[model samples]
Target: MKIAFVGKGGSGKTTLSSLFIRHLAAHEAPVVAVDADINQHLGAALGLDEAEAAALPAMGAQLPLIKEYLRGSNPRITSADTMIKTTPPGEGSQLLRIREDNPVYEACARTVRLDGGDIRLMATGPFTENDLGVACYHSKVGAVELCLNHLVDGPDEYVVVDMTAGSDSFASGMFTRFDMTFLVAEPTRKGVSVYRQYKEYARDFGVTLKVVGNKVLGQDDVDFLREEVGDDLLVTVGQSPWVRAMEKGRPARFDELEAENHLSLQTLRNAAEESYGNRDWERYTRQMVHFHLKNAESWGNAKTGADLAAQVDPAFVLGERSAVPQPS
Candidate 1:
């Protein structure tokens, strides 16, 4: 399953994302953690020391190769610049598998060894001085989305992304790329407001969103979220003293987190595990086409639209209702 964690800047979504990745690793599951946020803190949150995290390359920095691989040998793709987020995989496009043998994996992924299991980390680099006025953070995020769109993960595997905070995710269709999105919200008006905005926009895309309340101090805080989000509220995580200690430079593993924090992590794991099922391939492909056509009309060429349309898997668009299987 592919899961994304998004919310307000201080909502603790990054911390939660790291914790979930650690949880999957502890269970010996195959997982790749993508730090799609501009701040790029998921590495440190995953227990990588400053130096180790700094040494890792960002996927955004490898955009040239990424685009080249994705374009493959497709004759219709004349230049990498024409490759948009909704660009479908074509004849020569490289298929990404979580295993290290995949060229895409070799090009961008870094394995971080942890006590439980080693997890691969892929980052989207922060916007640099050169990008000033020349590019937007959305461009960096778009690289991550493009990589994900080309990836095929096993049922027991996961791709956990830490998305940019707040409504910025709506800047691109990246918000619709996940099987599930965990919106980590603080028990405050502003936090709940972001949730409302996300739900309203994502409703039409068939994206499943669940709320994870963070930094809840008391029943009052919990009640506020319950009232605002209702049953969409899945887990409420109180401020973790263990996390605070770690922030202070104390060493701590995920399993050693405070009891409350550990339980909250388990709740998230259960939800993810239970979420495993069949994907609606027809619906997914239709949505991709919708976004691709919309993008083509706005910024892409007519041929780009035609090429993308032709790339949609026949079984998916032909109304066969067959399962569009991925690598297991």
Candidate 2:
């Protein structure tokens, strides 16, 4: 399953993402955690300090190599530079297997030690001074977008991503890529407003989204969330001293976590697992093709001087498991 954690800034999406990854890992499940946020703090939320987290390879910095490797022997693609982020995988392209060793993971991911178990972590990296006024954060996120587009996961394997806050995820077709999205919302009006934005934007697509209420102290807080998001609310997490300790760099085990909070995490895991389906894979391919053509028409054709729309092999549904047939 491919899952995304998103919400308003400071809504603790990173914390929930880290906890969920650790939960899945502790159970001996195969899971990968990708930090797609421009802020680059999911590593810290997991366990890494300032220096350690910064040392992991940033996917954004290694875009060319990834494109080159995934481009594989596909005859449709002439060069890595011409393969935009929205490029869909087709016959002869190198597809990714979840939790399996691959060149992209080798170049960009790292193993993080959590008390419960362990997780494979990757980040899009932080926006740097060099990128100041020159690149949008989406350019960095493009690496992750392309990675997800080519990735194929089974029922047991999981990929959990910490997405950029709020409606910003709607900026790219990446928003439509997840099997499920957990939008963390606080009780405040500002937090619920983001929920409205996500609900409105994702409703048109087949995006499966649920609201996870964060930092609730009482029934009133829960009521506020229910009223704002209605049936979209999946579960609520109360403030936890255990989480506070984790935030301070003190380690924790799931056994020691607050009982209710632990249960809430399990609920989230169940929701994600239940969301797995064979039906959505076709739509995933179309979204990639749609964005590719949109980008091609807007700028990609001028930039690459080739018809980028030809990159789409209509019969190839990216996340679907089947034999690929070459374009005729």
Which candidate number maximizes lDDT? 2
Tell me the TM-score of model 1: 0.90
Q: After superposition, how far is residue 271 of candidate 1 from its true place, in Å?
A: 1.5
Q: Write the per-residue lDDT of candidate 1 for residues 113-164, one digit (tens) a residue.
A: 7659999998887778899999889878878877766666656788999999
- For model 2, residues 1-328, the per-residue Cα lDDT tens digits are 8999999999999999988888888788888899999889998988899999989899999999899988888788989989988888887898887766778889999998766566789999999999999999999999999988888887788999999987899888998888899999999999899988988888888888899999899999999899988999999998898888988888667679888877888999888888885447777788788888998898888888899988888777775464233232
For all candidates, the clash counts are 0, 0
Alpha-carbon local distance difference test for all models: 0.78, 0.87
Clashing pairs in 1: none
Model 1, stretches more than 4 Å misplaced? 75-81, 302-328
Q: Which stretch of 10 consecutive residues in model 2 shows the poorest summed lDDT? A: 319-328
Worst 10 residues of 1 by lDDT: 316-325
- What would the TM-score be for candidate 2 when compared with the true structure? 0.96
